[model samples]
Target: MTGTTDTRPVHDGHHTVGELVNQAGEQLSQLVRQELALAKEELTEKGRRAGRGGGMLGGAGAFAYAGLLGLAGTGVAALSLVLPLWAAALIVTAVLFAIAAVLAVTGRSQLRRATPPTPEVTIGSVKADVEEIRERAHR
Candidate 1:
């Protein structure tokens, strides 16, 4: 007989209960961390959208104020001289108001898009993960 022998433990595709339990715990921890990270990312994106919408709304307000100033100039021009000067100022004021209206509409749409800031996708993923874990646990 040859004097050489291999002395490695064979793997039988089975784990002890303690090892399984430990593995399950680690997996659960990892799943929770992943879910939290996903939630954080979703919330951060919503916050950025809200900020942009708010800034646009602020710009609309500023434009509206400028429109008010232009209307005041139109009034002064109308009182001082003929229709041409006042008509030009009125046209400028109308353009300013139109721009403000456009900005207001755009900002409102952006705000609507950012509404209901919840981690909906992450919530659904976590619910699915729970169901899967439950089914496996039963098995």
Candidate 2:
């Protein structure tokens, strides 16, 4: 077998300068289409993940609210069992209001700590892909 392969340029119908330019343009168009499709898929996946995260957070908030209400009800019932009607009612209302305020603060803290749906990974990936394509095109 020969060590060096044939180096002669083969003419496969697209031999003219215009034809070569047209071919390159077509390939570039295809590359853009494929990249757009990939971006769409990535965005769709990211959107779904964000939606699920939001739903889970909402469910957690609802559960916490229910728990706070239950605790407040228990406190009112226990106090009413031993004290005068009006005094017990006042005390229970005060305790329940305090509990509610605490829960509100806690909920606000949780929300503040929650991670935002920034699509960081997806955007980074797309930026890398765009840079790569730009480099390849320049070459």
Candidate 3:
């Protein structure tokens, strides 16, 4: 025979069901770890967005308070340029409100993008792994 052979029994040299089961357990553990990581990342991103949005909302509240003071000619009149106090106050109020609107909108959109924190890809992969294991077990 041109081919060389290692004279070993097939079952002794090859993998067995016990080994496969152990490997499957290891793989399952790894998959769970990966899924947990994904969930953590997702929640972290969402939490950051929520924090930024809340901060922007707080900023909007502050600006609105300042606007009220501007109208009352108490806080913003000194900061006015060549324009009259009321006109400058109105202009500052409008600009502050516009910036708040933009921040609020941008923050809201970021928050919306991270609604559910489930690891969808990992879930699907686990389901498929279960199905494959079931099929192989049947054989």
**Pick by TM-score: which candidate is best?**
1
Error of 3 at 6 (Å): 13
What number of backbone clashes does candidate 3 have, counting pairs of residues 3 or more apart or in separate chains?
0
In model 1, the number of clashes is 0
After TM-score superposition, the amount by which residue 48's alpha carbon in candidate 3 deviates from its true location, in angstroms, is 1.2
Query: What C-alpha lDDT do the candidate models reach, one value each?
Result: 0.84, 0.79, 0.77
Which residue runs does candidate 1 get wrong by more than 4 Å? 1-11, 68-116
Please give the ranking of all candidate structures by lDDT, highest first, separated by commas.
Answer: 1, 2, 3
Candidate 2 Cα deviation (angstroms), residue 21: 1.7
TM-score of 1: 0.59
TM-score of each: 0.59, 0.53, 0.47
Query: Which runs of model 3 end up more than 4 angstroms from their true locations?
Result: 1-13, 68-139
Model 1, residue 11: distance off in Å is 5.2
- Cα lDDT tens digits, model 3, 1-139, are 7999987557856787788889989987987787678767766887799899999999998998788666646535665657777787787778778978999999999998975656566677668877987898799
RMSD of 3: 9.1
lDDT of 3 at 65: 76
Error of 3 at 70 (Å): 5.1
Clashes per model (N, Cα, C within 3 A):
0, 0, 0
lDDT of 1 by residue, 1-139 (tens): 7898777555598877778899989989999999999999998998899899999999997998798887767675764575576676766677778978998999899998874668899999999999998898899
